[model samples]
Target: MSTSLPSAEPTPSPSRPALRKILHIAFWGVDAQTLARDIQAHALTQPGWTERLHITAHDLPHADCLEAMQTWLTSELQTSGTRPHLSLLVPSGAAQNANAGELQLRNALISAGVSFQVLYGATSEERIRNTTNAIALTAKAILPSSERACFVVSDIAKPINPRMRSWNCEKCSDPECEHRLFTGLLPA
Candidate 1:
């Protein structure tokens, strides 16, 4: 009897490394530092989040917020930076407006060369509550249950002058100590 030819073994292909997962949270009319602190204090306190998840907070400009976001995304892409999933917090209003804003923002990001998937529309709320429920819900989608976090954004009244400068009595009388602006008050 003739010997049968030996069967060839199947070769396995090399597996690709998994991409790093990141979450980016952007807030309008909220201080970046406060948001970051709240997220860390409220959300990251969970167990698994300390190791697997990473998050960043940004304070969006009231005007042209989308455009600024686009620029930021473009820079990150150009620099070969990791593109994290984005979430936006906006004021509560008609669903139509929210939808429109979402589309425009999505388009802006895509045009700016973002490669990662952008999920969910804007989360809206009229006022800050004890816990930012909407943000927590959104975070839960991508992060583990323990890592979901939220924030309460309180508005601060604008000072008489928002600008900053060194105080100089020669410039004007009654220099606004906070901003160093001359309030035009007559010298007492």
Candidate 2:
């Protein structure tokens, strides 16, 4: 007698594929859109899924991003007449641990009662792409699909490109180096 191992996720039925709506808050602009699209496209190519990604709004601030977010939210409520329930899949590509900006964004959202979840990040080039895959993997662990959701790449996200680098991490010791801000490994 051969014992078969159980399948990880129930094999999605072809007849009834999962349908989901994704409103992308593209704080990272084209970068975020690319990541979101990659994630959604991969999901669609998988066994079962049908999704629509609508780039919802672009109001990220260079200085204070969450302030723009709050204003946008208020305006949206006023226009739509109903608060859109959001299951935000926020994928941030940052190497270091949460800093003040990141914390502030989370805190403001918490105060506003906006639902969200943040994804992990790493150093060097392709940080955004790696984070995208990581987000998809973790998300699959929770549920294969959802009824409604949002893909949010935080405005605080700094794209890492090591190709044209001038500053050396070893030579630089400034704790607040702009180079190290987004892609440096935090000290233990």
TM-score of each: 0.35, 0.39
Best by lDDT: 2
- Give all candidates' CA lDDT scores: 0.39, 0.40
**Per-residue lDDT of candidate 1, residues 1-188 (tens digit):** 01111112223346744333344444322333444455445445443332333445443333356776566556534443455444433322333334444454456656855433222222211122212344444466766654443322233222223222233445535334523433434463
Q: What is the C-alpha lDDT profile of model 2 across 116-136, one tens digit per residue? A: 544333432254454444444
Question: Model 1: which ten-residue window has the lowest total lDDT?
Answer: 1-10
Q: Which stretches of candidate 2 lie over 4 Å from their true place?
A: 1-31, 51-59, 63-67, 76-92, 95-101, 123-188
TM-score (C-alpha, index-matched) for candidate 2:
0.39
The candidate that achieves the highest TM-score relative to the unseen native structure? 2
Show pairs that collide, candidate 1.
Answer: none
Clashing pairs in 2: none
Q: For candidate 2, what is the total of clashing residue pairs?
A: 0
